[model samples]
Target: MSGDDAKRASDAASARDKLLWIIIYSLCSSTMLVINKLAVGANGLPTVVAGAQLAVSAAVVVVMEFAGAGVLGPFEKKRIVPFVLYTTMFAMGLFSNMKALMLTNVGAVISARCCLPLIVCSIEWFFMNRAFPNARSVMSLMGVVVSAGIYIANDTGVDIQGGAGMFWLLVWWLLLAVQMTYGKHLTENIAMTQWERVFYTNAMAIPPTIVLYYATGENELEMEDGEGAMFYLILSCVVGVAISYSGWKCRSVITATTFTLVGVLNKMATITFTIIVWPKDFSVVKTLALIASVGFGLLYTEAPLRKPKVAGAGTSPLGIKH
Candidate 1:
């Protein structure tokens, strides 16, 4: 076969691999939501439950590292600042997300999170000194807004005045945007293997998570006594972090667009699981609106709306040049 054919085949394989990882990540994320919901139902506090899961996940990653899994180069003395910044940002994002889960419906939380890619783009442009394709970026931003509008219109049970719920949800979105932007920044300087990155990031995230857990007066041991709580906690830690991180690492190798799109699509899993586990009555209009909102979000995040660029054109400092 010609070199061009070989390259095409290679690209196709990579795409398939990325897609698989996306699916895995989405499933894990969805499962985490389900487990979180279960924990709440069992009277477990969101902060405590999530913190426990994160602690376990971090421990697992650390154990894997010590078991000849991967060496940590990114944690070298010089890179500590960037490492801490990204990890703390991630911890804040996770904490906010758990708080939102406690306050709002899963679907609402997921829908609002669709704005993260746009936020990341904006942050890159303003703070990181990166330039995006203007037309494509505008289109994508519009799609996100339209999608969010559809979801909001369709949502019948959402209470805007639900005592800090909406506030927490919005906070979750903002923090996730920060996490993504900072994560991209850290990726630039990190020389560790994917596992090592996951291990260290989660390791660093543990301290803040634990502090939040205790400050909120939530107890991990007490939560485990509740029905199905142990199972939920285990799933949250093992599947949610470990599996999702592995999948994310694989997907990042393909394309930034693919990674962002896949991340957005994971919200659909939340909707799906919510419907299955918490099936609330709704009108046809509402149902259609929800479907459209999610569809638009997927398209907005993943669609190759950006024109293919010439090789070696100016790259985004955030690492999303393509």
Candidate 2:
């Protein structure tokens, strides 16, 4: 084959690898949510549980680095601002999500997160000076919103009266969107490998997470019996933190649109797992609505937008250059 053909083949392989990483990350994240629900239901404190997991994952990364894997690296000074902000956003999103899980059903929380793509897209357009392609994108955003509403309306298990829970869940979704966008910016300049990046991010997160864990009066060593609490904790550390981070590294390679789309699918996986494990009371209408919301969010985020053919030319409708 010609050089051009070889380059195209290489590019296609890279894309496939990235997509595989994303799928693994989404599945791992979904599993983390499920394990978290089980652990919390078994009386595990969310802060302590998550903190411990982070600590263990960090240690594992450290060990891998020492083993000549070159998977972790020294933190860069210039990236501090964005790194800290993104890490803080990560902590807040997780804290809010865990709190919401305690107060509401998993399905409801997942449904509420359906709005995240719209939030991310708007943030990119308005705050970051990006633009969408056409009316189709806007309609797709509306579809997600409407679908989320239908799902929520039909959800009998959701405690709308759980005032603080609802508030925190919405806040969690917003923070997640912001975190992803900011994370993208950080990835643009940071030179670390995927594993190293995850290590550094989690490392920075440790001190704050520990403080929160202690402030919440949660004991790290305390594990309830018969709850599979320990197993869940380990799962969160290995699969959730380590593997999911690997997946997200691939995501940071793609456009923010790809990241959001993967996230929406991850939410769907979480919802499906919740239904299977808990067998909650849910309506077909609600189920369909939830599916639709997730579907639309994926569609909107992945929609092919027009791009400028010339570099440094006028901005394309899709906010990207071809």
Candidate 3:
């Protein structure tokens, strides 16, 4: 084949692979929250549920390695330290999401998450040296925030009487923003395969999750629904592994802003399914707000990285040209 033809073919293959990763991550992540809510609600122990899923994922990694799949890389302080930091925040975010789900309906929780892309994008721009979003993208992001706010204002899905539920949701949102941005950073800058990244994140999260479980007095597992809870827990673990793998794979190919944007957009399916299955406090206004949020999210594009100025040709301390 000619050189130009070969390059074109390779680019096409890369784009196809990227789309596949996006699809896989979206499906697994979208369903994971609902499954986790079911499992946690049944047992009334979010930490226990999260810990179990992480344990299952960690074991899968070990099994893969033993089977000669070679999912893990050699131990190194630099790589391991970043994974540890990310894992700590990951565990906290997972637990807080479960807590939020317990106190509110799926629609409300996911709707609140619509605002995350703005935060993620801003963090990437300031701290990670990513470019600023264009005017159109910024407008779309603002629309997302405004729509999410409208939904939250009209929402009545919180079972909790006061602001405690909102507090948990807010905490989850912030932690998720950090996790998304840092995860993208790891994917871009860290020298590791997708499996290694997945293994490290899932395995390292187990310790902190166990600590949280016991500290929260959730050591005992309650079986309120017998087979139902067990069923959801098992389902959650299965999807957890898939998402763990696909998330890293997806992040490796996409920008932080696009990754977060895909997350918000894919939840349209989740929101529809959620409303159908658990239609608590569903209203026309809320529906319109969701449509607006996802619609505007669709309009967002990943901002290109800023071009370095070439006055002196030496990089600044922040890895950008002065």
Predicted model with the maximum TM-score: 3
- Tens-digit lDDT string for candidate 1 (187-306): 554565666566666667778877877776775436546787666666666765656476547545533433554566566545644555566754455455556545554443232224
Cα-based TM-score, every candidate = 0.75, 0.78, 0.80
Per-model clash counts, in order, read: 0, 0, 0
Over the stretch 1-322, how does candidate 3's per-residue lDDT look in tens digits? Answer: 9976676566567666767787889889988978998898877777777888888888898899999997778999999999999988887887898788877666567566776877888898999877988777888888887877776677754354358778888889899999999888898888987888878888898788778877777766554664488889899999998998998888887778778888877776577567656778568887888788777876766665788632433221111111
In order, the Cα lDDT scores of the candidates are 0.60, 0.66, 0.78
Scanning candidate 1 in windows of ten residues, the lowest lDDT window is: 313-322
Candidates by lDDT, descending order:
3, 2, 1
Clashing pairs in 1: none
Per-residue CA lDDT of model 2 for 181-212, tens digit only, reads 77776677666677766766777898888878
Global Cα RMSD, each model: 5.2, 4.8, 6.3
Top candidate on lDDT is 3
Worst lDDT run of 10 residues, candidate 2, spans 313-322
CA displacement after TM-score superposition, residue 166 of candidate 3 (Å): 9.2
In candidate 3 the C-alpha lDDT for residue 89 amounts to 89
- In what order do the candidates fall by TM-score, top score first? 3, 2, 1
